[model samples]
Target: MRTIAVTRYVTPLREGGSLPAIAEGDDGFLYVLKFRGAGQGTKALIAELIGGMIAKLLGLKVPELVYATIDEAFGRTEPDEEIQDLLKASVGLNIGVHYLSGSITYDPNVIQPDPQTASRIVWMDAFLTNVDRTCRNTNMLMWYKELWVIDHGACLYFHHSWDDWEAQSLKPFAAIKDHVLLPFAKELNAADQWAREKIDKSVLDAIVELIPDDWLSAESKLSFDEQRTVYKTFLWNRFTHSSIFLNQAIDARKALI
Candidate 1:
């Protein structure tokens, strides 16, 4: 385990409804330090680190992330002191999320990716355990003419446990429903097929093993491992028995991108 000490706590820049950004690490890295806020919790922090890391491993574009522990002293106020005290009182916060530079924000409708491209992102999200992309918010970034997804701190299908399965709610996340209807479905299917064949039990296990233990402490790490197991199991099941959706996503991605 590599332990990087906290060097300095920088002022936070608010983005959307997400956590505040704090500190520029000695290593020239920027991190969003999750303070004890109105709604922040351990689950969100864990999900962000684990989900982002998993997406990177799945060969998708994601921001670099590192876990950090902030102490009370680092949470003191600045000269401006306009910021809320609790917002700065995070010790042992998630730090070192790469602050993207020269990135432009665009509404989901503005970037208008083709159906194929959109399908690929959907497939990627489904396979990598992302559960945050929804109708109201498709959090993404456009830089250098490329669309990059962010704020996956709500992934891992934690809500799947709820059995409500309302029609409207299901429609949004049913990767099956969205991707299969895409015109680019066929191509996305082919790509997913190829990737699926390459993925085996050992490979999945190896990927899970690479997760940093520091990010999830001993007890929490165990729970995190269980989540990975469920993720892999669901992935295999979907690829084997429900491949139609996967195919559609692949084709859709090709058309959009």
Candidate 2:
């Protein structure tokens, strides 16, 4: 991932709990930055990094993700104490998604993606065990007449508590039925086949490796390498047993249709 120095504190995007912000990067681009110092801390950033990468790897449309550097001087002028503390605590590496200028939230009633696209999104969410992306909060955007996914901090939930991660990997995501795109996801089988072909041990390695050590240290008591292993193992297990979730999605879609 490319690292950019955050030069300006544009504004705080207080939509969600993490308190993401619109910041200007040294590259002359505006980015929606996910701070590492927020309540969820670096774990959320890890999920955002891995989830966004996997989506891009699956040929999904996602804004460019970068490692945003929060230098000591940044955010010093923010008048809000909460925002200032968040900036002070996050004076290091954070995650940023290139802001899609003029992008609007996706409205299911206004437009529905094709079956194949919908099915792929459903399958990907199931694979990640993402619990966000619902009617109330679609977490999707329409930019330049194309669909773009964002805010994946809710994915990889198993990492938050690994006590049953092994078993958790095999369980189909029950929440998938509530997915915003499930109604049009008629191509689950096709998505299953595609994912099985695209994601492998190497692909998982690449994505997991992108996670900075700072993010891994806060998780559990395990060493960074150990945590990475657990993550890779869990993801591989889920990928191999994806049928469990694919079937769950198909059943849910069946009920919906």
Candidate 3:
């Protein structure tokens, strides 16, 4: 959506594998910057954009996604060699999530969500095929007493191998069993019905259109339109075939109980 220039490199948030940074934007707001030049590359950024947008559409709490511009000159002043290398590689447009200050990491044991909210979240993760939201690493935040989903770079794993995307899209998401909220997700069937109604072809198209062309063309052999089509097909197939994963989630909830 909005493009912002990274004015300052505040610090590296070393919690995850990506090493996303907390930086000040030209808009005078703090943002968690996901570098385009990182080891995971632009695909990870694409996952974040698509997953975050879908979550927002499903009425889940997610920070605003922004295009963050970074100047190569800014890397010269960084003291850490690791961060310096990362900045040097990410000299152009990057993905930034508006930072939520005073937000605490979500702990399922301490703060439990209602079954409806939890099931919606579980359904969202299953539909996206996100594998990172386990009890060990929730990748979620509790801000202002609301549960916010974050760090979706690990979703959409099929993108790494587009040849089998069609089959992968239909495969059940077994990883959903380990989802932190699975035990509390009592409304999986209802959540699936609601999502099927909301996330149609038009919604998938709008979300995939948000990804920049530069990211798609950087290292891929596919054309821009081809890339967009691939994403749309994968997501639409996943949404339509969600009953497979919905049943898995319900079974997991039963075992937990």
Best-fitting candidate, scored by lDDT:
2
- List model 2 lDDT by residue over 1-257, tens digit each: 89999999998887878899999999999999999999988889999998999899888999999999999988788899999999999999999999999999999999999888888889999999999999999999999999999999999988777788899999989999899999989889999888877888999987998989988865368888889998899899999888899999999988988
RMSD of 1: 5.7
Regions of candidate 1 where Cα sits further than 4 Å from its true position: 1-18, 33-40, 78-89, 93-95, 114-117, 159-186, 210-257
Candidate 3 residue-wise lDDT, 1-257, digit = tens: 89999999998998777889999998899999999888788889999999989988998899999999999698798889999999999999899999999999999999999988899999999888999999999999999999999999999988877878889989988898899999889888889888877788998999999889878865678789899999999998888788888888888788888
Among these predictions, the greatest TM-score belongs to 2
lDDT of 3 at 233: 90
User: How close is every model to the real structure, measured as TM-score?
Assistant: 0.66, 0.98, 0.97
Worst-scoring 10-residue span by lDDT in model 1: 164-173
Any residue pairs clashing in model 2, and if so which? none
Q: Rank all candidate structures by their lDDT, best first, as comma-separated numbers.
A: 2, 3, 1
**Order of all candidates by TM-score, from best down to worst?**
2, 3, 1
Candidate 2's C-alpha runs over 4 A off are none
Q: Is candidate 2 or candidate 3 better by lDDT?
A: 2
Model 3: residues with Cα > 4 Å off, grouped in runs: none
